[model samples]
Target: MAFSVDSTLKELLADERAREVLRKHLGDRSNDPRINMVLYLSLRTIASFPEAGISQEKLKAIDEDLRKL
Candidate 1:
């Protein structure tokens, strides 16, 4: 599957490369228990939440990495 910012968290997490990209950008937060609650949400949706701590720059970096996979 082609992964992008619009990809759901579950879809990204299902791919090891995508998971690594998320880990690189989000650190421990990528594995947080709360992540389960948003698995069905798109990266774009989650990034929109200020509490998610994902700045637009970070999201861009993540999108770039995901594209490489």
Candidate 2:
């Protein structure tokens, strides 16, 4: 799970479009705790959104993945 998370985040950062999308939110925070907090806050935001943009099952999977880590 750690590897998957690491690789996925790497992929996101490696892609120009995704990196551009995330650069403002990511800034210079490259540490684990900061990254984890970002993930938590992002999920919290998505979970509370009025419009159903993200699926509940996907959110559950993210929770499960974080628990595994």
Task: Give the per-residue lDDT digits (tens) of candidate 2, residues 1-69.
Answer: 232223345544455554543443334445545455344344435345555244666545544544443
**For candidate 1, what is the lDDT?**
0.90
Name the runs in model 1 displaced over 4 angstroms: none
List candidate 2 stretches off by more than 4 Å.
1-42, 50-52
User: Candidate 2: minimum summed lDDT over ten consecutive residues — where?
Assistant: 1-10
Clashing pairs in 2: none
| Most accurate candidate by lDDT | 1
lDDT of each: 0.90, 0.45
Give lDDT tens digits, candidate 1, residues 1-69. 889999999998888888889889988576477988999999999999999999999999999988888
Q: What TM-score does model 2 achieve against the real structure?
A: 0.33
TM-score of each: 0.90, 0.33
**lDDT at residue 41 of model 1 (Cα atoms):** 99
Q: Model 2 Cα displacement at 58 (Å)?
A: 0.7
